[model samples]
Target chain A: AQSVTQLDSQVPVFEEAPVELRCNYSSSVSVYLFWYVQYPNQGLQLLLKYLSGSTLVKGINGFEAEFNKSQTSFHLRKPSVHISDTAEYFCAVSSFSGNTPLVFGKGTRLSVIA
Target chain B: GAGVSQSPSNKVTEKGKDVELRCDPISGHTALYWYRQSLGQGLEFLIYFQGNSAPDKSGLPSDRFSAERTGGSVSTLTIQRTQQEDSAVYLCASSDRDQPQHFGDGTRLSIL
Candidate 1:
């Protein structure tokens, strides 16, 4: 079985400032990592996914995440954040090639301040 | 074409009543999924459908929760004798393969 953990429950950062949301996973076999964001009253949108061949994955909306195999971590980062970026973020892990169900983290609330 | 669509954006039902949530996946999306989000629980996988076969229903917390995808397009989730703990947002997602999943706005079910 695979599981995910989000280190922070909430993170507040000023607009245009860089921010990172930490995520870690536990799995015996190789897995695919993903990041999703949910705006107020909206569904979760895919930010990015790490399948293979790349440790650093770039995503839409000026966001990116790095996959650390040894540490089993996939932390999302953005060089600069906007007030609109304030939302809920979730990290998920699934078995190789998406053969299994995704295990989602508890999620982190990103509150961007202007 | 557009994305996953869920009906009845918000539903409020009294305790002990049954509720049904609906989802319409994008055209030709072979994979579909259902999830629940509570106040503290981020997202919990409820069930998945690949074509007409549902091989994984392990995430279902109890027997009262049931889901069915018909004609490989739309899915309906039924909760029997709803409890207060059953109040939450239900989300639906669809994928074409290993591709990223597209999500619906979700049906906000509130059990009162």
Candidate 2:
């Protein structure tokens, strides 16, 4: 089984400022990591995922995340945020074999202020 | 290309009534998943279907919750005797093998 923990419940940042949302996971075996964002009244949108190969993975909307193996962390980062970036961000993990369902974190609400 | 689609964007029903939510996965996707989002519980996996194999019902909270996939494309999630605690967003996702899941807008179920 895998479990994810999003360190922050809410993040407030000014527009055009850099930000990082922290996430950590615990698993007895290898796992895949993912970041998803959900806007108001909308479903979750995939931001990025770390399956293999690279430690830094980039995704849509200028978002990126780094998968740290030793630390068991996958933190989402953005060089600059926009007002539209305000949303609920979730971190998830699943077995590397793809046989297990994703285990999600409690989510971090990003509030990008203008 | 169409992403996953879920019907009944919003559903309001009285407690003890049964409700059904539908999902249509993207074309050719062999895997589909169901999740629940609530205030108390953030996001929770409910069920999963992969091809013709037996669906994974491990995440289902209780026997009152059930789901079925027809033709390996469309799925229906049925909730029997709903309660106020059941009010939440039901999300559906689909993906190809070894691919990231694409999500639907979800059905916001409100039990009164």
i-RMS, each model, one decimal: 1.7, 1.7
Query: On residues A18-97, what C-alpha lDDT tens digit does candidate 1 reach at each position?
Result: 99999999998889999999999999999999999979999999999999999989999999999999999999998854
Q: Score the docking of each candidate (DockQ).
A: 0.66, 0.65
TM per candidate comes to: 0.97, 0.97
DockQ of 2: 0.65
Residue-level lDDT of model 1, residues B18-82, one tens digit each, is: 99999999999888889999987779999999987799998888999999999999999999999
Check candidate 1 and list the clashing pairs: none
Identify the candidate with maximal DockQ: 1
List lDDT for all candidates, in order.
0.92, 0.92
